[model samples]
Target: MHEGTALPGWTEMLVLAPLEWMELVGERLCVATCATVAYGAPSLGTPRPPAGMDYVRAYVLDSADTRELRALVEARIAGLADATGARELAGLTVRFRRLPPEDYASSWEKVWKPFRAGPFAVLRPSDRRALRATDVELRLEPGAVFGTGRHATTRLCLALLATRVARGERVLDAGTGTGLLAVAACKLGAGRALGFDIDPAAAPHALHLATQNGCADRTEWRTGGFEVLDAADAEFDGVLANIYSDILQAHAHELCERLRVGGWFVFSGVPDDHALATRAAFDAAGLRVETERTRGRWHAFAGRKPA
Candidate 1:
């Protein structure tokens, strides 16, 4: 799709496969469609798949070449069975449907309702819902990036930040998707917060979010990875990281070094399967794990840097 061009509609393609093959199928779909892929059940509102089977969905620009796309997807699926020797993959099928013309940009707003995360009430920029007297308001426009406060990892990090962020503290948010954590820290009374992500598109979205939340002056968004922090001094009072377990483990020492002595940190987005290994990495970096939280298959850790 061209930049800024209005989409007429979308051709939605769904591939049905078993649970174990969903990820591989989703990857192949992305390659075939040259777009992002999502995994879920066949039902609209259902979050998980039925028993062992799941659906992988992708969208292509509505055009006359849909049949070609379907053929390519089928070929990819067939190749998967040959590559993995999993003959069951050969049974997978790709279904296509043409969606009506509508504004796909704002369509998500119809289903993304406001929700509370710890002391903060997370809402869309256009939501007009009334807030309670004690509610700390956070306005977000969930673009292509992550950290919408709906994900369990984000909520867990927010809950931990609510308890740990002290007034006038300097905060660092690594892998700051929509700058939700950094902006939230500023809202929670932190003096300054700096957030960065490897995705080049992340900074603009995050800056807009900070401006919407009235914390742009106190928050800074940058485009890069942890190396962006290397030019600065090690003076952050708190750190927030909601990223993959492998990335967290790889940068544990670097993250710990950025904090001041006895400073606090919140680390989340680690699946339960990697919880023990992640904990070992944190401990190896000299962080004292003070609290551990789990929701579903995810885990979050809150702790402090030792003197």
Candidate 2:
């Protein structure tokens, strides 16, 4: 179910499977899990499943590797069928259709509707969902980079931001995918927000999101990593890093240094099993853990630099 501009040369693939199989499939495929129902998009239509089969829909991004990806997915489906002894499931089907070039943007609009994460509600600009008086609505568009606030790691970070970001503070968001966190910080009344990512493609996407949220003037997006954090530029009152566990562990000391004493620091993207070690690394760097939250198998931690 893709809704986008009629762009030529892009293809969208849809896979339908039992709801019970989605977790295993997501872990194996390395794409979003249960994306079909993650947002508030109105149901396009439900596919009829076999007797007693509860179905969920998922998507594979259109990319150069898609063909190889489909082959791997089909192979996994075959293995699952054999393991479950459900021979009928061996023939799991996937749907593919070419998207018109102009429709690409509309396609994102169709899926990324308004959804709440703690006090924040992430919505596309066109979303009409009712909002609570206390809700901070973040309007964004899907981008090539991650961090749209849908993933567990991003949500945990958002929750911390909502609680800890004071008015008129400075924020530094490391590996700012889609620039969502930086924009969210600005929306939360941060005087200035700076974001940097290793991916060269991420700056534009993050900058665009900052603009979409009307915080472009308060946000700066750059491409690179910790090198962007310089003493001459000034330390931040809040720092966010939603990158992987290893990177966070590796840079724990430097990240803590980027924040002023008593400032907030939020780190996520650590799997639950590694949370303890990640926390210890920060503790060693003089940051004291103040909050920890987990969703699914991912863990998020919020700490503060000791004054």
> What is candidate 1's CA lDDT for residue 77?
74
The CA lDDT of each predicted structure is 0.84, 0.75
Query: Tens digits of per-residue lDDT for model 1 on 176-288?
Result: 99899999999999999999999887899899999999989998888998878765546799999998899999999988988889999999988766899999999999989
Candidate 2: lDDT over CA atoms? 0.75
Where does candidate 1 clash, by residue pair? Answer: none
Q: What is candidate 2's lDDT per residue for 1-307, written digit by digit as tens?
A: 3545333354444445555455344443344321222321114565455554544334443553366666765666557777767565577665555544544434555555467887888888877878889999899777557776788789888988888899999999998988888888888899999999998878998888888888899988889978876778678899999998889999999998888999999889888657899999999999999899988678899978997
Model 2 alpha-carbon drift over 4 Å, by segment: 1-106, 128-130
How many clashes does the backbone of model 2 have? 17
Query: Candidate 1 — number of clashing residue pairs?
Result: 0
Top TM-score prediction, candidate number: 1
